[model samples]
Target: MTYLPLVNGERTYLATWMDLYSRKVVGWQVGKTMEDELVILPLRRALQWRQPVTGLIIHSDRGGQYVSAELKELL
Candidate 1:
């Protein structure tokens, strides 16, 4: 996952999750605040839609949101 800052004058965040094997975006979410939900929502959506088997590996930068206790529990 990654956070992208939009160039729309006002600050906006775009969070995305990609499937490395396919090199395609599996899920995404846009929000005004850079909160944990920004990353978690996309991850939950991807899990619900793709339903990958166990032992799935998710690679992401060491952002605070990714390391949060809530997110760790979810994973």
Candidate 2:
């Protein structure tokens, strides 16, 4: 996740999922808070849109949100 600086030094978070094979951004979401939903929502959208076959792999840095219970259930 990354942040976009707003006025007064406040920020919003952006979460994205990319198709590794195609090098295309498949899903993204932005919000005021950097919670698990930031990442989970994008992944959910990508899965619904792509509907890839079983055994697909999702890769990410070792971010705490990625290991959340909700995200694990979705995966």
Candidate 3:
């Protein structure tokens, strides 16, 4: 996950999408923003590699980064 750097103190964000069935990482992205779409990039990449995400269950920490109006709408 993205976090503040101790030395630089920059607010960073990390986004990752994983597959529940095989317990494998599907994809990931990194940036400095926390908009709802922060998690979308990775999700899209994962989707391209697997079948439809019909039964996918996305789970993560309750950080504002994970819960956003755009993400709620987009996902």
Candidate 4:
């Protein structure tokens, strides 16, 4: 995740999911607030785009959103 400052002084967050081997961004979402949906939505997009089978592993920092029950259930 990354934060960007806008001209209006408010900040926006970008959440991304990248392919580890290719170093390419597979999915991404931008939101005004750092919420679980920011992370979860990108993961959902990545899954549809990549369509990987089982044993898929995801790595992320222990942010509250990343560890949320909603995200865990989806994973």
Candidate 5:
């Protein structure tokens, strides 16, 4: 995840899910808030799009959104 400053001087958050094997960003989301949904939305989109087989692993920093109960449950 990264925070970017908009032209208005406000910051927005960008979350991305990359496929390590392909080295490509498979999913992403941008939002005004860095809430759990910010990360979850892109992850959900990746899951829905990729539908990878079992034993998939996801890695992320220890940010609040990444460690949130809601996101943990979803995973």
Candidate 6:
């Protein structure tokens, strides 16, 4: 997990992603907006270091960040 100070007086949000099997942190990013794009970037980076995340169990807080329509569609 990563905590990023909000810039420009925006709200602070944490983005977390974990790899179930390895119990290792697979992806994380800190930014002002809880947009799906932000989450996808780190996920993309993590995936770059491994195989397809088809069955990977990714868990995160029930924040707007993880509940975006685009992200859910992608998932």
Ordered list by lDDT, greatest first: 4, 2, 5, 1, 3, 6
- The local lDDT score (0 to 100) that residue 19 gets in candidate 6 is 79
Per-model TM values vs. the true structure: 0.87, 0.94, 0.64, 0.95, 0.93, 0.58
Question: Distance from true position, residue 75, model 1, in Å?
Answer: 0.7
| TM-score of predicted structure 2 | 0.94
Tens digits of per-residue lDDT for model 2, 1-75 = 899999889999999999989999999999999899999999999999999999999899969999999999999
Task: Put down candidate 4 lDDT per residue, 1-75, tens digits, no spaces.
Answer: 999999999999999999998899999999999999999999999999999899999999989999999999989
Candidate 2: stretches off by over 4 Å: none
- For candidate 1, list the clashing residue pairs, or say none: none
lDDT of 3 at 17: 79
Clashes of each: 0, 0, 1, 0, 0, 0
lDDT-better candidate, 2 vs 5: 2
lDDT tens per residue, model 6, 1-75: 345555666566566567777788777777766667778777777877766646766677766667887677756
Q: Which model scores highest in TM-score? A: 4
Name the regions of candidate 6 deviating beyond 4 angstroms.
Answer: 1-11, 57-64, 67-75
Give the better candidate number (1 or 5) by TM-score. 5
Question: Which residue runs of candidate 5 sit more than 4 Å off their true CA positions?
Answer: none
Cα lDDT tens digits for candidate 1, 1-75: 434656775667889999999998988999988899999999999989999999999888879989988889979
lDDT of 5 by residue, 1-75 (tens): 999999999999899999999999989999998888999999899999999999999898888899999889978
Q: Model 2, residue 27: displacement in angstroms?
A: 0.8
The CA lDDT at 37 in model 5 is: 95
lDDT of 6 at 2: 49
Score candidate 1 by lDDT. 0.86
- Give the higher-lDDT candidate: 1 or 2: 2
Lowest lDDT block of 10, candidate 1: 1-10
- List ranges where model 3 is wrong by over 4 Å: 4-12
Cα RMSD (Å) between model 4 and the true structure?
0.7
- Deviation from native of the Cα of residue 22 in model 1, angstroms: 0.9
Error of 1 at 34 (Å): 0.5
